[model samples]
Structure formats: structure tokens, C-alpha cells
Target chain A: MTSQTKAEQTGAAGWTRRRFIITLGAASAAAAGLTALPGGAAWSAEDAKTVEEEIKRLMGGKELADGAKIISMDLPQIAENGNTVPLEVSVESPMTEADHVTTVHIVADGNPRPGVASFHFSPLSGRAQASTRMRLAKTQNVIAIAEMSDGKAYMTKAEVKVTIGGCGG
Target chain B: MAKPKPRIRAPKKASKGEVIEIKTLISHPMESGQRKDRKTGEIIPRKIINAFTCTYNGQEVFKADFHPAISANPYMSFFVKVKESGEFEFTWVDDDGTTYSKKSKLTVN
Candidate 1:
């Protein structure tokens, strides 16, 4: 939270620039490591473009803004096996019929298909948290978007590096 | 047809209006169609659990739509509010149109 505020204080000079550089550096390093394995090049080349396209498709062409405060995604920085990447998603909501999360979408940019899963919820759920095991083809950002009942969307993303490809090798 | 084993874990009892955790696991290969046979080199047909749903006391609690990216023997955990004594109906739909289901009873005090 403090760092995010500091980033905001920089007004796109310090925070966004630093975050962008860090993300780019990490992505390149991870991509290099992934491409070293058999059939890794094909997976490493999948950039954030696919993830954006997927979010667009899932949103039905709806627009999305940064949801740093509303959604939280839990994933490992490095996955020993790509076949069973554990994921957990949680959203801030009251779980009341008046204002509750309606759906949560999961997407992996490097997978053969961008759409990984979508979870629906209601007031009966009591909370908007979901955990499951997912297969990852390579190093990529796994995105989670939560749709609220009042026609609003929030999202968060995490990157997972796969040592061994999960889908096929 | 052989039955697919679906298992669930939840509190046998809970206080009314208390939030509790629910866990589910189903035994499945969850074969994604992207693989090839080691010998014949033919594309393996995809067979995965595509959806999962849970209902409590006849009221829908939570639901999820999965894809080939889901691992074999898919396992998931979520939360629910227990209002009354009833059962949780857990269901999983596979790519082959197979619906595997199981139920667990809960007592709310």
C-alpha cells in the first residue's frame, strides 16, 4: 500500500516507470529461462497482448480499470510443475444482495487458450474467494477479474514461472 | 458406467450464519487435447472437467467454469454461509458430457 501510494506520488515518472522496468526485466529473465527447455520458445513469445485480448473477450468488449484495491490474486513466483499451479482469488465485497460479486474470471496468457476458468457467486456464498489448481504452459501472467452485481469489474494479476510445461511437452 | 469418485470436505456442524470453508476434490485424468501419444504420435483427445457447482439446502452457493488448463484430479476450495441444517450438493461436468456428483450433510445449530 505504501509503495503504491509512493508510485502515485511520482505522477507516472517514478512509480509507473520503475514498475514497468521491473516487470519487463522479470518477464525477460523468466522468458529466457522458459525458452531454454524443449518447446519453450513457442510459449515464451506470448506477450501481454494475448492477456488483454482475453480480458476484452471475457468482458464482452467492456472496459476495465486498475483494480489494485478490490481484487487480490495469490500465486507462486515460480512453479516447480506447471500441471498443478495452485491459485487463489479474493475480492472485497459485503456479500450482500445489494452489492456482491457476480463472477470471477481466470485467464493464463501463455496457455493454449486464454480462458482458464470463470466463477460465479451470490449472496449465499458469504465471500468472494476461490481456490483451485490450474495447468500452465509456461511463464505467464494469470489474471483474475471480479464482476460485481452492480455492473462493475475489478481485476488483479500474478506471474507464475513453470519449470516444466504442464499442458504438453 | 463406472462412477467418478467425487469427494468433499466441510464442517459436519456449524453455527447459524457462520462462514465456513468447503473443499472438493474429484479423481479425473483431465486430459487436455493438446498432447500426443508417445508411440503413435496422435493428438490425445481432450477430456477435462469443464464446470463445477455447489448448492446448499437447495440454494445455489457457488459455481465455476473450468477449462483444459485445469489440472487432473481438480481440487477447489471456497467459502459458504451456513444458515440451516441441510446438504451440500457438489457436481462436476466433464468434457465428455459426464456429470459426477456427491453430497455431504451439514448440521447448523
Candidate 2:
């Protein structure tokens, strides 16, 4: 009788409880195996959106943190070389034992992964600072995000002007 | 690939409210493993500066993970606000577990 009720609940989603359990087992099996299917041949604007969703899902599906006061991004007004354009991000946070910046992610809009890199931090980090030179295929906005220990999120971004093609188009 | 010579350049000293800039560069080819060798006809293995970390007096100042997409001789510069004089150590790690490191001392003025 109890199993019948569980089956009824699963039936709402058009899945039998027993079938659902089997599907879960198969998913775990797939997760442990080298079963990644090759995706599309090329990246498009839709791919960019999907990548954004994937990264956000990696972050627990939280909305992007974007604001002006807490986070800031610095980039060259005009990139002399798309191969190595300087980028920096800093958060105005007092890195203390009780409060500190947790992580920062640099994502270029047009890149394949978009999420180029991420930095995890602790109170040991005296201040919130990170800088790196990045490769941009074309003019695009570089997004910088920061998560704080206090459960607050902040973001900043800047557009880079890419003049020459670096990928040898 | 050759062992990269890393540069660890930092300020001589720092005081409260002073922002100390740190500069670093490593001689690396930063191959993305996507291209084939001109002669060998085999794909050049992807090797890159995967991670960079900085610690101040046993505390971390900043850290970053790089990708093959980064340019050769990755040059990075960032500033840290000085609260007290301490030692700053920088470490760079490549994809093959090879680690290159350098350190400098900061004296509070």
C-alpha cells in the first residue's frame, strides 16, 4: 500500500517510482564513467548563454552579483594586442578574520568556456585583489565576480576594444 | 618545454594604507594542446601556468588559476594593501605539477 502511494506521487511526473530509482542508478553510473558526448561543433551566441547557465549552476544556480560600490574592474581602454590584454579586479573589503572575500571568477563573454578562471580565498588573504592579462578574440565585456564571507555577492565589468585579430583568422 | 625562470618582484617595504604592487612573469610557451607540432606531426601537449598563489607572512594575499588560453610569458601585476611588514611568497604551478616559486620581504615604513 505504501509503495502504491509512492508510485502515485512519481506518476505526477510521468515516472514510476521504481523507474525513477533505476534512472537515478543509471545517472550515477554515467557520472562515474567516461561518457561525455562531444557537444556541438561550434560555439554560438546560444552557447554563450548555456555556458552562463552552466557556471551559474556550478555556483548553486544563484543570480549573478553585479553592482558598482563593492566591486570594480580595470582594463585597458583600447587593447594594443588581443593576445595579452591586462585585466584587474579589486573589492573594497576589509579582509578580517570574521569577514573576507571568498572567491573571484573572470569570464570573457566570447570565450569558449567564458569562465576562464576562479580564485578561492580565505581570511589569510590580506586584501581582495587579482590581476591577469587575458586573450580576447574581439571586443567584449569581461565580467568579474566576487563572493564574500558575509554571504554577499558583488560584481564589476569592463569592455575591451580589440583592434587586431589574434586568432589568425 | 623548458623550465621557466620566474620573476618575483615586490616592494622593499610597506606601511599601513600603502598599496604595494607585485609583478610576476614566467617564461612559458603556454601551449593549449590544440595545435600540431610543425615537424613531429603530433599535437603539442597542452601545458600552461595553471595556478598562481601569493601568501603574505603565512597569510594569502591573492591567488589565480590560469588557462592555456593565456598568452606566453604570463605577466601579472596586482597590489596589496599593507597592514604590517611581512614576507611575501609567490608560487606558480604548471599543468605537470612542476612548481616555481620566489619570495620577497616587505619592511613596514
Candidate 2 lDDT over A132-162, as tens digits, reads 7777656777877788888877767788878
**How would you encode candidate 1's per-residue C-alpha lDDT over A107-150 as one tens digit per residue?**
98888667788999999999999899999888888988889999
TM-score for the second chain in candidate 1?
A: 0.94
Query: Candidate 2 at A123: error in angstroms?
Result: 4.6
Model 2, range B1-109, lDDT digits (tens) per residue? Answer: 5779898778796667686678898898876543334343334466778888888888777787775447778887766777788888889998789899888888887
Q: Which lDDT tens digits does candidate 1 get at residues B8-48?
A: 98999999999999999999988776665544434456677
Give the top-scoring candidate (DockQ).
1
Which stretch of 10 consecutive residues in model 2 chain A shows the poorest summed lDDT?
A32-41
lDDT score, candidate 2, position B57: 87
Candidate 2 i-RMS (Å)? 9.9
The candidate scoring highest on TM-score is: 1
State in Å the error of residue B46, model 2: 1.5
Q: How far is B31's C-alpha from truth in model 1 (Å)?
A: 0.7
